[model samples]
Target: MPAEKISSLDDPRVYKFTLQKDKELARDQEIIVDSPKVVLRMMDAGRTPKAILANQKFLDDHGQRFEGMDCQVYWADVPLLEKIVGHRLHHGVIALAERPESLKLSALGHRLLVLNGVNKAENVGTIVRTCDALGVDSLLVDERTLSPFIRRAIRVSMGSIFRIKVRTSADLFSDLQTLRTSGYQVLGTGIAPDTHRFDKIDFAKKCALIIGSEGFGMDSALVGLCDAVIKIPMRDHVDSLNASVAAGILLQRLGAI
Candidate 1:
């Protein structure tokens, strides 16, 4: 039987038609093309369809195909994306995607990092990258933390955001109690004169590192709840480091490097 042709974008039958390898190759190679929506995954070095759409002439010619559907054109190359997103790297495509739902804290365990009130998307992204690099078991984001999958976060993380398990919390203190009950040691970061160095903390035991925001630092209530509060020693007038930078330092101190 001859395969049916798709006549309309809205037809449910249209999804059933699979593009053959040759056809897919042809589509990928075509200089000007259109789709209902173009999903970009990374903005690395490459000739992307997104790049074409940024051009007025090319968009004028091919933009009609993407008409009526949500459209985003990446006129700026990788450097421009980096500047706009506040991160240094983008893997050539930025995917237009649905936001993923958050997981529950009850569903997590093992080595975990809790982000408290860290609002900078780039910081969130960098921590995610460190977590993945260190093989940390999971990530928990309090209400104040930025979404790990946001464009700047994704770009900064170099896609490591997808590799880590993430959960959200309305009350991080309550969540800390749950982790404590589950035999997880909750450690908070601080730089008071009496605090222990992060390297002295035993990470071989089940643990969670509570990282605070870039500006205000962790809440005192949360700090008091920790099994221990630790800090990384520094030189000069550096009173502190960026939350993400501190996270990487702590991870390395814990032998995660």
Candidate 2:
């Protein structure tokens, strides 16, 4: 399609489409991907783009990527694009892409991450990127966990979210038990009386590492049912670590990557 020109940021369709809430993205099946790498990654993952909004420089440099795609390409001068997105552009590229369909728990792989109450999108994004890099098979998100498809999450993940299977479990407790029945050793990450050092755990078995929110940590009931609790031995006065950072350390040790 020929490139189109966006004349105004106040265009109703632009606001309606761009201002979607994180939760709405899954229902609407649409996402806004920023940066050239993330946009190109989304296309490579076989997700279709609804449209692409870029500055003239990007259009001139990379516009050929969209040559035969069934989507609109809108290019504007720098200032105009900044006005529309309400911020300085990131690598002068933004794309409106369709969200991938969610997978079921049965469809997820052997090694998994079951996020319990991990609500920060940025942290979730970092974890997703780590999982993709470390070869953690899939992600099973609880109801309270943030959606990995949000703009900030997708950007931070660098499109790694699209590379892994993601399934949302409506009931966190029940799903954890179900996984145990399915031959997965459910391990929760935390500091407790019974917490085992990272290397002490046998990672050779099928495992599902459960990560909790930064502030409150995992719920007591969920922690009690874990086959074993794992912790990273940190020095100094640090009692805890960021959810994503802790996940990366654990994944590196357990992921065998």
Candidate number of the best TM-score: 2
Q: How many backbone collisions does model 1 have?
A: 10
lDDT of 2 at 147: 84
Query: Candidate 1 overall Cα lDDT vs. reference?
Result: 0.62
Q: Which ten residues in a row have the lowest lDDT in candidate 2?
A: 11-20
Per-residue lDDT tens digits for candidate 2, residues 135-207, read 8869998878888888999999999988989988888888888888889888888887578997877864678
Error of 1 at 139 (Å): 0.8
Instruction: Estimate the TM-score of every prediction.
Output: 0.65, 0.93
| lDDT of candidates 1 onward, in order | 0.62, 0.83
Q: Show model 1 residue runs off by greater than 4 Å.
A: 1-92, 254-257
Clashing pairs in 2: none
- How many collisions per candidate? 10, 0
Candidate 2 TM-score over all chains jointly: 0.93
